[model samples]
Target: MSFAPFSDAPGTLDAAATAARLPWSALAEEIAALLWDSTVSVPARSVLPLAQGGSLFVMPATDRSVAMTKLITFTPGNAGTGRPSIQGDVVVFDIATGERRLVLDGPTVTARRTAAVSLLAARHLAPVPQGPLLIVGAGVQGRAHAEAFVVGLGVQEVWIASRSAASAEALAAHVHALGAQARVVADADAALPHCPLVATCTPAQAVVLSATPRSDAFIAAVGAFTPTMVELAPALCQHVALHGTIVVDTGDAGHEAGDLLQAGLDVATMPMLRNVVCGPWTHGTRAGKGPVLFKSCGWAGWDLAAARLAMRRAAAEPPMPAAAVRVPA
Candidate 1:
């Protein structure tokens, strides 16, 4: 049989387009429902090491659709020899027919969806905070978080902190250009007191950053995905012991994530995102600490959802033979 192929070039659907299409508040509600529904199931992800320094992730899930996505992350050190620091593709197929119908450049989708998930977490876990916002890490995810928060949540001020001062300054400039009050802070700790809402977007191995929220502060950490990568200290997990909910992308994966692992915590006890959104149990006095701690280990369901959304949007456009044609047997 002959299969058809369609490609979405990088920036084809710029950050704004992606942000507009996937509204964080709406998507967060949908994610909450999906999590509570028993029909939806996301299998454990499979990781494959690339010949270079990066690794590829094969994520598969079953719900209304049986979908699989392949994601690869290459570091600068590996890309120097002509490899991309982050590159890959996603192929979405029709469940019954097993027809590969949608092809997407994975990196763009990854960044957008990752930010979308972070926004969802912030919306559900953090209390409404006024004033400037603090974003740790000035990479793609950091920028996307700033854009999504301002557009999705009405955030006014944005302060960025990065290992690279230049990167932080550049991100701050971009945010200001977007009409939001923003600046780069040399000290993340100092920025924390002023901003009630803090998001850590770095991939640091240890607790490179910390925050002292004023009684009602909300923190969302999405940087670390593996056991070796950590952005928040273990003590932060103790915050959950005091008050608020700790929402993890998945219980099993959290145990493998550095923030949770280093904290010497058990993921099974950590509340999943759905629990916090649905209020499975009264959060109790801990709830008084603030809203909650939201941590994402990254999930395949997110990729599947994004792929589905992108495909639906593409179909609404003028039909292209390559996009609509079926494979020939």
Candidate 2:
């Protein structure tokens, strides 16, 4: 039997649409299952650094029925050039036939799916009714987190903090424009007490969020993917040792990320998302904690999952000719 390769156009999904299509809890559960399943394969990503000061990553993943390759680019100056900071394309392939199936734009997908993952961690581990969230860094992650917390987690108030006061104010205004209660804080440290939920989104080489959070607080650090970037302080790692559940995205990435490396933290001993979902909750571990800390290394599995979700949604709509193609021999 000859298989026809269907060329699905790269669909552009806005943040709101993406959120509506892929809920945080559902995506997180899907990711958790994929990670736990022994049949699925997610290899270490391949990175290509741009000479102009950005990087691209190619991530490939596959199971029996589904396979996907996602190309993600991080261009910091793209925002100044009237483009998004992070953008890319995801190509989904038929695992059995090895035929191209679908293509999806990844900018909005990354933002929405990343926020969903963070929200899921908060929902399962963070303290309930945790309000007055503090978001450090006024970048894409900051804005996305605000929306997810408000729409998905029912957060009442959000405080925006950045090294640049103007950026923080602007982010606050943007979130408030969406009808959420949001404001800018002059001092990130001062806002810690009021924030039961804190998200660090900056790409800093040193710890930006150094203030100790309350025992009942929940923290999500989305920055610090590289060995040089650090968002949470050594003290925060100590706090995790003493009182909170320290959940890293993966053991290998955590070993390289500066936040863990600087603090001499070992993810080999830390509880991973896989452990939380599959294992028994024992005392003095991720299973027991009032304040929980989740550090995301931005895995490829997330991009693959988000791409699959987006493709499924795009497939459900009235078929567009742009999404179809004639196969050639």
Candidate 3:
């Protein structure tokens, strides 16, 4: 069956166009609003293992006016195969009419929304919002975080570290292109004390960051999404849990957050992003704390937030000439 794009049909945005629609500032705000919105409902995602050693994720979410589902695949073996390991689409629909409204690049949505979530966490939890940033792991997520922090937090400098020197340098160049001073660091641990804002975006097969950060550091760990995948040392997790605040993006992190789970941290007792954003807690309450750790596991609600922002931005613009428009992939 072939489905052609009708004149009134919602536009299918590619990665770049989708990114353009969901600006960091607006997207972060939308997510923050949605976090406390009772009208929005997000069911737990279903993960199915493919025969070829990959996983398919089916995540669905809905609000009073719109609904969305993110269908994506993650194939770790796809690395170096010239194809992205995570590729798919986020399909949005009008709740009243039940008509499809937009199709967004899923990987792009994941990267941006995840980074936006981190930005939102930083906005409320970071001891120092503007800063020299240290990102561990120079992959898509690392690059996305660098851009988000620079634009959203007005970060002026970024330090990148990866297992691959070439990858680290490439990310450094990307940061420099964003008009931020980029430094490639040989050791992420060595840079931790200097950077108040830190993001770990690694594969999560093992611990890559175990350093003791400054008392005011805000660390966002986005690498591990499973109980077995780990990026931070168990000791580090314990330290933060003991001294500082460890806020999770969602309650699902209870089982999916490897860094906390492995460290024997009871995620169920921790304050969620919703609590911090919607509750009465203030940054001043964290004075003299060791560090604030924001542990993020993937959630469909984040994708829905991105879709809402993208749809609003798309609606405000005048139609482009047919010839000037780039067809969606």
Candidate 4:
């Protein structure tokens, strides 16, 4: 598929412009196709330490159609300097010609693609999604997941919980603005027993939800990427034999998801997101029954896929007045 004029369009996009061009549903659907692809390819992300006490990450993903790379940086000191702790840009390229195509805002790509990963998993793992939902964080991922799920699924009620009461209320308002029934909850426990669906998006260094997950619950834990950072209790996966195995974006996730690594589960032993999307998950008990949850550390493939979708959709629009247009890949 050729991503015409739009893919090769000139000028770098800011966060707002990037969001305007990439629709939530399109992002979820495009990522869905990429997830089930048996041949999906993405090399392990390259991590390097920065001399200033932070880090730099080089992540790239591509296929036969197009390619993209996100050059991101992590600067811990920037947090106190009134600057973003993470910053980067996404560079898209034409697969066949090896020519650079477009440069998109990295944070926007990261936020949308990351949220879409968990939502895509929920789409398949929680096939019977309905009723109230719980979101564990109130930051960017929190907002993105709320929007993606509320827009991509049939979520009726969304409950936001965060360490900061103000943060939770802010996200609740955003969800309500999306035309969904939403409110700020006291904490995760407030909705655990009854809320059938949940997505944890916090930055906590330790476990967040301590209650035993319901047999029918579908939790998407999107926070805690490093080994030292954990967001879910180990019993969740340990009980998969009787309840469910954690659903992950890729086998690679097990290496990054503290929840899985700390649980003593091998990435090779778990059912990946691909398995859930393409066929009956092999990890579930006898008949693929019981509780199901998705854990996402992160993935570059999602960025490549969502960027392509944005380009394809943006190209279909009537020619813009000022943006330069280039030919297809």
Model 2 worst lDDT run, 10 consecutive residues: 320-329
Candidates ranked, most accurate by TM-score first: 3, 4, 2, 1
Best by TM-score: 3
CA lDDT of every candidate? 0.68, 0.73, 0.89, 0.76
Clashing pairs in 3: none
Candidate 4 C-alpha lDDT tens digits along 60-139: 98876788898998665663354666688888887887666577778788889888877777767773577478899787
Task: Write candidate 1's Cα lDDT for 1-329 as tens digits.
Answer: 75444332222333344444455555555555556656666788887776754567777766665465655654635322444356666666667777665555666667767777777767665666454678998877788788778877888899888888877888988888878999888888777778878788775655856554555677778878878778877766666546556678667665566887777777777777666556754334254565466777788777777766666666675544443333333
Our tally of clashes for model 2 stands at: 0
Predicted structure with the largest lDDT when compared to the true one: 3
Candidate 3, superposed: residue stretches over 4 Å from native? 1-8, 320-329
State in Å the error of residue 67, model 1. 2.2
Q: Local error of candidate 2 at 301, Å?
A: 1.2
lDDT of 4 at 151: 85
Clashing pairs in 1: 74-85, 243-286, 244-286
Residue 329 error, candidate 2, Å: 22
The clash numbers for all candidates, in the given order, read: 3, 0, 0, 1
RMSD values, in order shown: 4.6, 3.9, 2.4, 4.7
Error of 3 at 236 (Å): 0.9
lDDT of 3 by residue, 5-61 (tens): 566566677788788888999999999999888999999999999987789999999
The Cα error of candidate 1 at residue 318, in Å, is 4.0
Off by over 4 Å in 4: 1-9, 36-40, 51-53, 75-85, 280-288, 319-329
